[model samples]
Target chain A: MADKVLVFSRFAKSMLARFAEKFELLETGGKPANEVFSAAELADVRALLTMGAQPLGRETLDALPSLGAIVCYGTGYDGVDLDAAAERKIAIGNSPAANASAVADLAMTLLLGLMRRLLPADAYLRGGGWSGARPSPLLRPPRGLTNARVGVYGMGEIGRKIAARVAAFETDVAYHSRSRHDVPYRYVGSLGELVEWCDVLLIAVRAGPDTERIIDAAMLKRLGADGVLVNISRGSVIDQPALIAALADKTIAGAGLDVFEREPYAPDALSEFPNVVLTPHIGGHTLEAHVAMQDCVIANLAAFFAGKPLPYLVKR
Target chain B: MADKVLVFSRFAKSMLARFAEKFELLETGGKPANEVFSAAELADVRALLTMGAQPLGRETLDALPSLGAIVCYGTGYDGVDLDAAAERKIAIGNSPAANASAVADLAMTLLLGLMRRLLPADAYLRGGGWSGARPSPLLRPPRGLTNARVGVYGMGEIGRKIAARVAAFETDVAYHSRSRHDVPYRYVGSLGELVEWCDVLLIAVRAGPDTERIIDAAMLKRLGADGVLVNISRGSVIDQPALIAALADKTIAGAGLDVFEREPYAPDALSEFPNVVLTPHIGGHTLEAHVAMQDCVIANLAAFFAGKPLPYLVKR
Candidate 1:
């Protein structure tokens, strides 16, 4: 008999087939973890495969008495109860750096979009504003990205990729991280200094207790009236209320946001702001990123089942 | 007394002030050229400064008997009758490559926006599509720009800048030009071959009698269903009707367009297409580009008055 594995979230069809080859795959289809499987179904489950910010806590882990491992499909594993899993000796593995390129691409997309006033410009042209009797300055003239100073927060894989791409545009690249790495980009020791130095500040930090609301009122003020903010990391990194206030008051020039503090619910105030560009949390939603993440998850699961070290093991 | 120069187009205030230092500046304010000045005004006009696709034929040249030179503000001068100017011994100068960076930036913005499905994605989230009971795949997943082959239709200054930028993303860049220039990018001799070789085709050629409607039905077919087309050059280079049909039928995956055949009029057919990203003719409309172009115009005019070799002379 195959070792029973509970799929707690949706996986691509190809990934599902691969999972089935190694285990008796039981799918939750995004059902609550405890509700999806009865006591009898949970009794033999050896592992759980999940995606996104699904809450996996002590209660769900207690239900699966035989559960030896939990594998997350994407880089972020903030929702998982790491301490509980650590105490239970149930190893947690996440697909690390799987969608770095996709996220970095999005950072550039949002930056360029905001710089070009893409949303308003497209709307103006489509609404026949361009054919008016007089030329309307409906679309404000854009500032060029070339030779502008770009400061990246959290100099991780995604941030580095963004820096690399912007350098080709002749833009000066800088970064601020917990610790400086060996990369050639100028390293500012603090986020405040980075904000003051850059015309555009791109956020790419990982979300956690330490990082929550790190970009608060003070940081926005430092960014000043001409600075633009682009966030591809978790929305929790920014104080949404502070950001909204700053945008409204023109304390900062504009923003391009992909993630929100409340998922699927961007505030009406943010949507109403003409200078801000908003997209649903899709920074890493490319076909390439999806496939790579799925493959990463499979590799982790295969390694764990074979009693080999997990390739992307999450340490508590 | 200052030498009298006819300002046939509206110029930036800075440029106008500079022109005033050397000449008695006569402003047209975008009026019909014939109506803007009487026979008295035309007789003493020693030079003319104009912009855009303004028609300058034998009639205008004949009227301005004292017109020693004509300086165009931007690169495209197809509307100016070179033969008429040559016959009259009139020197023609243009601001060659003044706005190349701005145009290249917009080309990338459009390409990135289209590939990432930025338009529909922004709409979906703003319309609260993400709050639905199940995720709607309203926006198609994008293919990665990294490692993709990008074929530039013209290897001019703007095209080369785009290639340089994309190279940092790990994208392979190639081009099709009338003659192969000394560049690192592979040059394909024919447009058909370039279309076949690339996943993304960028149109950046100059529009002329020889190049009008260069991209037609057959070229679109050769681009195939998976390809994307980006045009930042002149709209006259594309057969608009053919492009519309191909976009509607998915003959090409999608397009990112900044120019159209008709000046300020984009068809309702294009505005209604979900896959295409349309912007008005603002490819080089950045503040930096505007300032640089104004300076270029001033330099050309100054060079002519000083009797130096024309800085950016256009030969017939």
Candidate 2:
């Protein structure tokens, strides 16, 4: 019999068909394992394929007696219980760097959109405000990206890509990571310092317990009246309430957000502000990134089934 | 007496006040010369400082008998009658390269915005589409800019700036200019060849008698269904009806337009298409560009009065 594998989330049907050739795929159809699969159905499962934010905890691991590996479809694996899998000697592999360019592109999109006030400007034009009196002053003139200081909060793959792209705009690029890398950009020690130094602060840090609410009211306050905040990382990295308050009080000039603390539920207050540009969490939702991520996931699963070392194993 | 100068258009009050120190300015308030000023008021006008597209013809030149110089506030001077100015030996100066960076920045904004489907995505998220059943696929997955071929229609200052910026995104850049420059990108002689070679065709050529309606139906059809078109140059550079038909028929994938043949009025047909991103002609509407343009205008006017060569004189 083929090695039984459980799919915890929906994937491309074509990709699943390819996987089916080598494995007896047991799909949960985006339902909970307990709700969709009985103990008997999960008992023979040798490996599990899941998405970045799919809940895979100790209880689910304990139920899957024969499961040896867990492969996540995207870079982020925050929802997976790393310690639980580690204790069981189960391999944890995630698709990393696959979505870097797409996320970086989104970061730039948000930054440029906010800086140019694209939303309000488009609205004004579409609403016939341009043909009316005082057309020149219909929208506030944008601040030029040329020579503007841009600070990347975390100099990871995505952040570095953003810095590289911003450099082409003739902007001054600086970054703040945990430690310094060999990159040419100026290194700031802390987030507060980065905030103070930059006209725009781009958040690209990894999310975890340590980074939860790292960018709070204090940092937002330091960002000042002319500063713009752009968050393409996990929403948990920022205190949403603090950001809302800051935007409400005009503490910062504006923001461009792709993530929210509550997924699919952007705050009504945020929508009310003309200075803010908001999008659903879609930083890495490009066709290229999706294909790359799926390929990475397949590679990791294949490697594990062949008793080879996982390609992108998460260190416990 | 201070040199009497007829202001053809309304300028910033601060700029007008600065000009007031040197010239006895007669303001027209953006009205017709005959309606705003008598022929007597224009008789002593020593120099004319106007915007690029202001209607200045042989008739207007005939009325301003003392007009020795014409200073355009922006780079484009298509509306000015150069032959008439040449016949009368009137010097013409324009603020060239003042808004290059700003225009290039907007071009990138439009390109990225269209590729990412930012407008509809934002609307979807704001309109509670995210809260619906399928949130992830709310917008069509965008193609990555990395390694994508970008063909620039013109290799001028703004176009070159755009190419430089696109390079940072890891895109392959090429150009189609009347004459090839010593730039790093490959040069395609014809617009058809350039369209076929690129995934995105960016139009940045100057609008003139020679270049009018350059991007017509056939050129767009050559761009193919997967190709995107971005226009940050003059609207007259494109045949609007052809573009609208191409968009309606899905001959091209999408478009990001900042200019239209008709000023301040986008066609009703364009608003119906979700694939296109539209903005009023605001590519150079930045605080930095505005200040630079005004300063350039001032410098040109100052040089003409000082009887030195105009800083940015256009060859008649």
Candidate 3:
């Protein structure tokens, strides 16, 4: 009999099909695992698959007496209580850097979309504003990408990728991170300095306690009226109300956001602004990224089942 | 005394303010020269300024007897009758490469926006589809830029710039042009071969007699169901009706079009497709590009007025 893997998060059936082929899956449909499965059924579950952002605490870990591995489906493993898991001798694994390129691609997409005023331009063309030759303030010439200052907040895989992509457009790239890495772009000592120095600030920092609400109103105001903000990082990196106020008062020129303060939920106040480009949290949602992540997930699960260390075991 | 310069196109007052300061302006507001100014008023119009896409044929040339120079405000000079001007010993000038970077930037913007399904993604977020956990087929994983085959249909400044931009995304870049240049990208023999070979075909070929309607139904069909087409070049290069049919039948996955068959007007049939991203001809409409082109225009006009060769004269 195959070792059963409990599904701790809601996932599309297609996404979960691969895991089903390799292991017996206990589908909880994002409900309490203990409620869905009897103690007898749960006692044999040795591994669990989850979305990295979904909460996996000590309480949930204790429920699965036999659970020895916690496999995060994406690069982020923020919600997993690492201390709790480690105390129980449960190994943690995550698909790191699998979605970096896709997320970086999205960061570029949103950045370009916002900077070029794509939404207004498309609407002007579609709404007969172009044909009627009506005055469109939004269609006016924008600050082109050539030689523009693009500062990246974070020097991680996604940030490095974003810097590389922007550099190709003839923009000068710089970054601010917790620590300096070997990269071509110039590094700024502080986030505030990076925001003040560049015309566009792209946030690709890892989400954690140190980064939560780091980009507050003061930082946004430092970004100035001509500056634009783009966030592919977690929404907690920015203060939602501060960003809204910044947009309202033109403290910053525009914003391109893939992640929001809340997943799948952005207020009308933010979306109502013509200068803001809003997207559902889909920074890592690409066919290539998904396949790459699944490969990591499969590899870790396979190794764990064979009485070996998880190939992609997370190091604290 | 300032030399009389006829403005043969409709332009914003702000755009023409600098020109007005240097010349005695004869604003025709894109009206016929004969209608706007009497022959006496037109006689001393030694130089003319025009939008590159507006037609300035033999009839218009004959009306301005002393029109020694025709300075185009942008890169293209297709609208001017070059042969007619040559026959009359009139010099032609254009701001060559002034808008190349801007146009290239917009091309990337459109391509990224289309392939990433930005419109549908934005709509899904705003329409509460995301919060509702509604199945968003449009938001499904897309084939990202990484390692994707990208074929450039032109090898001009704009095309070369585009190739450089996409290459940074880790895509395999190739090109098909009239003659192979010393570009870093691999060269393909023909447009058809390029279409069949690459996942995305970007049209950047210049508009001329031999190149008109080159990308027809057959070419689009060769691009295949998964292929995407992005045209930043003139609309005459693609058969608009054929493109419509191809889209209707799903011959191509999607398209990002900046120029169209008609100026300031697109057919409802073309605009109705969700897969297509349309922008009014604003590829070269950036402030930086405009300023650069204006500088070229000023230089050409100043040279002509001083009885010297146009500094930025057209070679042919």
Candidate 1: regions farther than 4 A off: A1-3, A10-24, A133-139, B1-3, B10-24, B133-140
Residues A60-167, candidate 2: write the lDDT tens digits: 998899889998877889879988988888998988888999899999999888888677667776666765634543345678798899999888888888889888
Off by over 4 Å in 3: none
Residues B1-316 of candidate 2 have per-residue lDDT tens digits of: 7877778876656557667887778888777777888888787788887877666899888988989988887777877999999998899888888988989998999888888877877887777787674554444567878778999999988889988888888899999999999899999998889998899999888888888998999999999898999999888898999999999999999998898887767887887788887888878788888778878878888888899889898864
Candidate 3: deviation at residue A140, Å? 2.2
Tell me the tens digit of each residue's lDDT in model 3 across A1-316. Answer: 8778999998878788788999999999989988898988988789999998888999998889889999999899988998999999999999999999999999989999988888888878778888888888554688888989999999888998999999999999999998988999898998889998999999999998899999999999999999999999888899999999999999999999998777767888987898888888888888898999999999999999999999898999
* TM values, all candidates: 0.95, 0.95, 0.98
- Summarize candidate 1's per-residue lDDT along A14-124 as a digit string, tens digits: 557766887788888878766877888888787889865777899888999988889998888887888899888988888787888888888889998888877877888
- A257, model 1: CA deviation in Å? 0.9
lDDT, candidate 2, at B261: 88
Top candidate, metric lDDT? 3
Which residue pairs overlap in candidate 2's backbone? none
The predicted structure with the larger DockQ, 1 or 3, is 3
Each prediction's Cα lDDT score? 0.84, 0.85, 0.90
**What TM-score does candidate 2 get on C-alpha atoms?**
0.95
Query: Using DockQ as the measure, what is the rank order of every candidate, best first?
Result: 3, 2, 1
